[model samples]
Target: MTSTPISKISSGVSRRNFLRTGAIGGFLLATGSATAMLTGCAKSVPASDRLFLREQDVVVLTALIPIVLADALPTGEARAAAVTRTLAAIDGFVGNTSPAVMDQLYQLFDLLSLPPARVAAAGLWSDWPNASEKDLLAFLTRWQHSSVGLFRAGYAGLVKIITAGWYLLPESWPAIGYVAPVRVV
Candidate 1:
């Protein structure tokens, strides 16, 4: 009986290490493609509409606002109106932000707009429009609790923007019991 050398057969890499390496590699690859896609998509936004966010950014925000403000947003036509108002608020807020902040927001939105980046960063495999409320909630929860600073920052930013937008609306004032100050003529 010929005895095979154990050392020669073993690659010495543990399964955990292999998986970690693979995950990192996949993340890097996805980010690279997403960056390339964002660069190519820069011109896709119409000149008239290209203020702070592109069309894709709007789509992302539309899909996410409900998830972020689940309890706050009403159902039926009220919900539709609220969403529209919130989107306009977000657009205005973005427009008013400094150039540096806007650039960072653009980068974040660009990543969220990409499929691979969305899956890798948010654990969301379904397209935003197709994603269930449960799926969206889970993704938000994960990012909110994530140890990664970038993920935490993203969670904070989304929540802040969505909540601020919703609360700033006059329609929301009644619900929140905020009486507007009277203007002095």
Candidate 2:
């Protein structure tokens, strides 16, 4: 079997190598900034319904919610309600965070929401709405075990945020054996 040349391997940027360089964020920021400028995303102000996450960001998070919360997420009819509640929770969590942290989350959301960044950074070729659950899971798994620290951190942050949203729902407590504490006057 023929092998790839060292020069070629070094010159060509694969997702792994690209992630290893720790420049994916910078690349995404630059591209996202340009896209934002052209598309008016830079001036996107959140509506009263949502504090920070925009509609596109909500779409991205909606796709992520089920996958990340899988078992903890209720099935059947309850699933929709749980997802809505979780979205609200996530919105509150992101909205109430420190400005710096909130800004970082916006950057992450922008990276995921942009088509080019989604494909290049996360290997998601389809838009968040059209992406298969399996594909999304693979992306999450890859980032979870990635050699790059940034990806690992991103994965951790995502999982933490998603789960926090899920657990914050009172209905989800039964699954995790958490009972709401009664307050005594």
Candidate 3:
């Protein structure tokens, strides 16, 4: 697995400090829940529709999948198919997590769903559907290098989720020269 380098900040806002202040919870309450209510996305979706990720989360991942996968991602019509499959894998991964972890993931997704928060936190002014590759890259780069520990944590979580989701798929194994172990009789 490839590791992302994070630079330390000289500021007083450490990860512990960020969590202790409940800023993320505040963001979720103020923006995420409000946006969800306004957009009617707070309603529970049917079981068959989605496991964990909401429709808005899908939009965010759809934009991010290609950029994160890069050369490993297939091109042409297959590109869309690959992304779809990877999303399913991601859903499965998220679905199996504990409820607390799931809630945290949802908070992150919801935060990104808000336009104002998306712009301020990710530097993504446009919706995920309309964001260019350059814009996406810049956002990822900024988060990776951000002085704020929370931003760095989010960056790490996102990259780990995306990469893990993609690599967990059997179809993606061949690309990285991974072959499942043979069973012993």
Candidate 3 off by > 4 Å: 1-30, 33-47, 183-185
Q: Please, what are the lDDT tens digits per residue for candidate 3 over residues 11-55?
A: 556667666547754653577677767877665451366798878
With a 3 Å backbone cut-off (N, CA, C), the pairs that clash in candidate 2 are none
On lDDT, the leading prediction is 2
Tell me, what's the RMSD of every candidate?
8.5, 6.0, 7.2
Clash totals, every prediction? 0, 0, 0
**Model 2 compared with the native: what TM-score?**
0.83
Every model's TM-score = 0.77, 0.83, 0.79
The true-versus-predicted C-alpha distance at residue 124 of model 1, in Å, is 1.2
Best candidate (score: TM-score): 2
Local accuracy of candidate 2 as per-residue lDDT tens digits, 75-181: 89989888888989988978888989887777777777778778877899999989999999999999998766667877988889989998888888898788889
After superposition, candidate 1 runs with Cα above 4 Å error: 1-34, 37-39, 42-50
